[model samples]
Target chain A: MSALLAVDGISKSFRGLKAASAVSFELDAGAILGLIGPNGAGKTTVFNMIAGVFPPDEGRVRMDGRDITGKRPDQICRAGIGRTFQIVKPFGGLTVRENVIVGALASCKTVADAEREADRVLDLLGLADKARQPAHALTLPDRKCLEVARALATRPKLLLLDEVMAGLRPTETDRMVAIFRQLNRESGLTILLIEHVMRAVMALAQRIVVLNTGEVIATGTPEEIAADQKVRDCYLGEEAA
Target chain B: MAMGRATRMLIGLMVALLLAPFIGNDYLVSVLILCLFNAYLAQAWNIMMGFAGQLSLGHALYVGLGAYAGGALFFHYGTPPWIGMIVGAAIAALVGGVIGFLGFRFGVKGVYFALLTIAFAEFTRILFDHFTWVGGSSGLYLPVVRADHDNLLLLRGRPAMFYYVILGLSAAVFLICHRILGSRLGYYWRAIREDQDAAQALGIDTFKAKMAAVMLSAALTAVGGVFYAFYTNTLYAESAFAMHRSIELILGAIIGGMGTLFGPILGAFLLTLLGELLTRLAENFGHGFEGVKQIGYGLILLVIIALRREGVWPRLAKRLGLDGEKAS
Candidate 1:
């Protein structure tokens, strides 16, 4: 079977500086793959290209063997890919349910159907009680969960998470990991996540891709990645050595 | 059936308005008609600014275009006013579509978008000023057909008849606004209003949604323009497309509680009544200044901004225990 998502030799440059250089990766259906890298490693740039924020300067992005490079963001989303921003964006003036409803409207035909999907997503994210509160009133962690809930309401086949565990406490991070695990195992949801939090990445990811300075430095199972000399020399630090 | 407080209150308000002309003096009826006319205009403007988060400071362009288009057809061609209204609305929608396509497609937004609208309105006014076919700068005057004064079909009518027409129009527009706000497009608009980039990321076609708002608003405003032309029996490019006219169209929505269902209507009534009261008070005190109404409006706007930045309707609704199902 064809891969669920294939990023083939994508490159992006802002002015003279290259943000991503020939980055390539493939994620199979129902797989949980983590993307790890140092700051300025062009992780988010890859996410942007995949989510159709902007087209890459060169190369193709494929979903289920269909070329989706250079499509509009909304079209890409309708093609079954959902994404979250690094900086959480909750529709501040709207209530929590309302924010999710906007995302749900993308997949559902009617407003009533969207509302039902929003409530279901909110319930899964444990935000049912705070559904009536304005999204601006949510705490930082709750806001992060709200972003996830919004994305989930789109009913995407592939979910792209950008630093969703940042600034979260250990327990909060664990809760998120458990939720992702349940989603992956029960629903076979494919996920590609960029995470700076190594503990969460190591706990959640079945395989890891390490990037450095816009290039893929290494890709392997967590144990294999931990044991790689080059990964230790560059990213995992001397402790991994 | 268990009716909500707001539903009951709205029914009461509509019934009172329908009975107003029967009990009130002609002078009072005229003022109410004026208030309802503004209410309709404000509601049309609200769809663009409030729901879609697109500020149009030169909405008078649509009003002027609609007034001229419909009025000219009726006067020269002897066409019925209702048909003229549709023709005018179509012309306004086309103009609005052009502006929307240019602005949104080229990435003009926020205050820049406002300026684009202003420029277009000013440009149109200048063009109309020299277009002698429509009477040019002197103004276009509709015929005073005394025999048709009470004929609703031709839109030549007495003050009482006009009052009922405007009342019906305002209520119909309000219901349309309410329905749109509850639909899928309404959700898209609210999302766009909060954050454009985020809304785009969430799979919303922001450009299409915004364009819909601009055209719909323009078309509705033009319908109001048709009403204005027939009711006043006169249309001047200077007054119809003036910057002050555009600002007047939006003030009611802003003061009423932008982005809410009832805010624009409440704001129109409050502003019109207060302006009239100020005029009377100034005359009674023998201190009637040339800009007394303007000064009163300025003061009222300041007080409202300082105390209730969200606008008057939300607060009033809350006080009346009607905030349970808040409309946005």
Candidate 2:
């Protein structure tokens, strides 16, 4: 399979502490790649660099054939990269519909087109029913759905989700997993999921990469990683199978 | 029910404002004119603060800069006030661009952002005071009587003329802000305001969007300042660029309703009337203290913020039956 995105020798050092040390990976097109890590393991930091929150202290991030490292976030977004924050930050004063419109308009030159696109994305996510409700009024799970809806509105070629299932119950996770799978099945989306819930990850990820202390400890199929020593070592002996 | 209620209130206000000029006395007309001007400035400020969430404290910087740029050309270069007005707005926009670039690039946040604006206003006041070419601290003055009382030239010297001009300008600003608040830029602004770090990660260039808002707001504010200078026929250094003027302008917006369309006008009218009435009341009661009204104004602000911080207009609009305007 052809890799759609490549992160080569990406390193980030904060003062004397190394947040990510020579991290490297590839995400193939039309595949679900699970990124697993313990807390403070540079999982989201790596996501931030790829999404252009900050330029890497070293190395390059490439999409298709273009070098996108150190570019402005908006430029990166327009070039078809979209991300969701670990902490959902919706426009608190705006309605749910308005929040999604922000993402839809990020690439649009005109207002009317953004609104139309935002409405379609909301309808697809089943958020059309609560479109007029203020974002502050939403419950946690729906707010997570809002984050996903907001990112999808941007129409990214690759979506980077950071712990979207962290606080969700099993039933909610199942519903969301179904929706995500449907999106991939119907639209050929490539998803990079950073989730702590192994059940969801094992069920969805075609391949899983386990990160420990900013370094990749293991990379293989879910079945292979479930049986691997390194994956077991990082998981503290809670084997998936 | 919502749209229908909004429509009726709009009709009622139209009839009230239309009748005031012809039937009302000069004092009331003057009050209305001032209210309208405050509404316009509040609208301009809202584009920056309410939408972009920049929290500027010295917006008088725009007002003062705009006043001088437009007034000076008319006073010296024999430029028509109409063209000079545009020039004033342009200069304000230029200054706004500089300020926005510096602040956004350097990552100014919250109270520090406010301090940066105040610093600029104070710096400008000092410069203008030293630069006697524009009349300095003695203040900029226009040619009195302007060759005749009935001069229909844009800069004609008459209260009635000034009133009409300010009214027209305020209406134009209202229409422009009305358009912007519904535009794509508007959504980006609120997004940035809500969370700048989050906005950037979602692929928003907070810098560009914020700079654009500031530039637009500055240009419009300068136009207002030009009228203020011409109408008053003077531009005192302290009064024109005072930090207090900026605070009062913000107060108008906040008290009226920070982000609502008509909040500023309501704020300006209420505050101006309060000041006028307090003066009349002091004189009538024979209890004369020059700064008492100022004290009262401060207390009122404190009380309003302590009580209804979101603003009086949001509440007023709800009571008057105007709900949030849904994007159509």
Candidate 3:
């Protein structure tokens, strides 16, 4: 099958420094692709480019064979991509359900329909009990779940999750990994995640791509990535040693 | 239960407002009218700043634009004030659109965006102060008709008529704001207000949403200005477009509660009542106490800000079992 999302030789540069250069990757439908890299590896930059935060300096981004490069974030989202921020951005004053309703409204015909959809998403994310609470009152793990719930409410074909497990506890991380597995298997939702938690990434992602300094160093199954010499020497080696 | 309380509170308020004119006191009626007028303007300002989180410290720009447009038409072409009001609102909306486009498109926001609004208002004030056609710094005066003969068509001088008109305007504006707060645009505005970058990531067109808010706010404020021109029977650039006017308009919104629907109205009534009382007290204390009213206002604002940063309305609403959501 054709790739659900294709990033072709994308490059982005800031004033005097290159944030990302010639970064390319493909995500197939129903696949969980883990993007692992050291700090400042330009992982977020690649996500931003694909999500239409800014136009890539060179190359193109295509979703399901249609070019979506340089489109506005809202347009890109409407065209079937939803994303979460590394730093959570819940509508602090709105209720947890209302925050999700905002995303659901993009597809729903009425507020009631949106609310219903939001409820389902919140329940699926195990946030139903906190549905009526203000988003600012949520715990870190709940906040992360809220972000995922909001993204899922948009009913996107592909979801880009940015560091959703960064501040989570081990149990919380495991729960999140299980959720991702269920989403991939049951809903067939394509996911591209940037994560620092190696164990969660290894457990959830069938395929892993390691990036170092804005370049891809390795791409293979999780087990293959564990044994790759360059990945070990550059990224995993520091953690292992 | 919360919805029932909110509904009851709204009904009670409407009944009180509707019966206010029958109290047979002209001074009281006039004061109430002015209170409602302030409420209307603050509500207009609230839509842009309160809902959309776009701080405009120069909201008087729209009001002044509206007054000049409407007042000038009436004074020159003999156009009716109703048509003038619509035309004035349209002009203000156009100006608002331009200002919003320039500000949002160029990425000006927060304090800088506020400064831009102030600069525009100040620039217009200076231009109007010099322009001779609309009477310049001396000011423009609507033809004073007999106060006893109530002319509803021309909105000629009559306290009762002005009171009822403003009451209607306030009600209409209240309904519009309530509708917006319950709609998709309201959700988008709240999202953008919380975090623009995150809102964009969620597929919200932050720029367009904010621009719509600016235009809507400006248009409504212009309508208030038209009423002010006809009701007060005079307009001057200094008083109409002054930075103090803008500050006065927003004080009600801030003091009542920034984002809540009823906050601005409550704040306006409370502040205006206190201001009137303070002014009367100063008069009783003789000449040197003229500034006491202003001092009182300043002190009240300071206390409100320090004591209850969320303002009086939200707490009051909660106490009355009417607060449905946390104030933004």
Candidate 4:
């Protein structure tokens, strides 16, 4: 089957700085694809483009064989593409349940339906106990979980995670990696994760794409990409590989 | 999800609405009427400032424009004040739409957005001040009516009519805001408020959402303005769009616990009564009261912010309720 999502020749620039240039990749159903890059290498920019934060200056993004480049973010989300932010943003005034309620409402046809779905997600995320807590009060890892939970509440087919594992401890990261693997295995949710954490990416990603200075430098299975000389030169030092 | 405290609060509001007339004296009734007007204005302001996170420092512009458009039509064309009120509200909505388009399109935010709104209000005030057709700088006034004539057609005859009209409006506004705040539209507004770029990434049309809120809020606030114009039968550019009015509306919401349905009503009632008491004290103490009311307002605001930053009622309400409670 055709790749579930195709990022075709996308390019984005900000104030003359090339954040992403002619970058292209594809993700299949139930796949975990890792996107890694140095700081300011436009990893988040590419993620932003895919999530419809801003349209690419060039090229198209396709999902399920349908072109969705430059579409509104909410429309892209409703089209089954959900994403977590690099810096988790939550509604401070809303309870944990209510924060997910925002996502549920965003995905649902009615308030009553969304509220029901939100309740289910609250329980499923192991956040049922904290359902009534405000989003701002949670510790870093819980807030990260809240971000994923909020996105998952949208019932997306494709979940984009941006640095979700960044601040998590090793144990928490391992647990989240397991959860991510489980999500892909059981839910059949395609995931495209951007991370600098090698262990988490290696634990979860089936395929990894490496980028440097706004261009794709390597793409292959995690092991193959790790062994590539150019990938080492760009991301890992020779020793890291 | 269960039958919790927010629902009870809503029920309490309903009960209070039904019983207010019986329990309140004439002066208290007048005070309540003012509270109702403030409540409506505060709610409308909440839609823009509270939900959308667009701080407006001159929302009083809508009220002034609304009062003028409706009041002017009644005085100049022999039209009923009720019809004129609609005209006023439309004008205010139109103005709001224009500003929203400009502000959102240009990505104006925080203090800049506030300054822009203040400038707009000032500009409108100057325009009205120069326009003699609406009585100019001398101010506009409707003819005094015969006592107890109860002229339903004029919408000008009775305090009870005005009171009921304002009450119904305040209730309607509350329910409408509550419904919208819980709906998908509310999510969009909150997303935009909390994180505009994030919301856009989720495919929300942030510009359109903000614009819609601005118009709706402006129109509804103008509705209150229409009531103000007819209830008191006078209008002036300076007083209608005063900076103090905008501050009062926002202060009421903030003090009451912004983002909640009942906060505005509570804030309005408290402030209006407090002001009334202060004024009475000033009167009893004799002339040249100076700036005691301003000092009182300043003191009360500081106390509230120090005691409860999010709001007085919100923290208290949260202990027993879900709607206004701080998350986690």
lDDT of 1 by residue, B97-123 (tens): 999999999999999999999999999
DockQ class, candidate 2: medium
Question: What stretches of model 4 exceed 4 Å from their correct place?
Answer: A14-16, A238-241, B1-25, B318-328
lDDT of each: 0.92, 0.83, 0.90, 0.84
Ranking by lDDT: 1, 3, 4, 2
User: B1-328 in candidate 2: lDDT tens per residue?
Assistant: 7778776776687677767778878888887777777777887898898778888888899898888887888889867767777888888889889988888899887888788888998999999988899998888888777534856475776566667787788778877877788887777788888878767766787898999988998888888898887777788878899887887788788877777777777787788788778887888878557776788779888988999998787777767666665521
First chain TM-score for all predictions: 0.98, 0.95, 0.97, 0.96
Relative to the real complex, the DockQ score for model 2 comes to 0.73
Ranking of all candidate structures by their DockQ, best first: 1, 3, 2, 4
- lDDT per residue (tens digit) for residues A1-241 in model 1: 8899999999999997999999999999999999998889999999999999999999999998899999988888889999888899999999999999999999999999999999999999899999999999999999999999999899999999999999999999999999999999999999999999989989988999999999999999999999998888778897863
Give per-residue CA lDDT, model 4, range B185-257, as digits (tens): 8888887887787666555778889998899889988888878888889888879888788888887888887
Model 1 regions lying over 4 Å from their true place = B1-3, B147-149, B285-288, B326-328
Q: Which candidate is the best by DockQ?
A: 1
Cα lDDT tens digits for candidate 2, A1-241: 5578898889888887888878899998888999887887888878888888888999899987689999887878777877887888888888998888888887666778888988998988889999999999999999999999988888888888988998999999998899889888898888999999888898889998888888888888998988887767767377455
Ten contiguous residues minimizing lDDT sum, candidate 4 chain B:
B319-328
Q: After superposition, how far is residue A158 of candidate 3 from its true place, in Å?
A: 0.7
* Native contacts conserved, per model: 0.75, 0.75, 0.75, 0.51
Best by lDDT: 1
**A19-114, model 3: which lDDT tens digit per residue?**
888988899999999999889988999999999989999999999899999999999988899999899989997899889999998878888899
Can you tell me the DockQ of model 4?
0.51
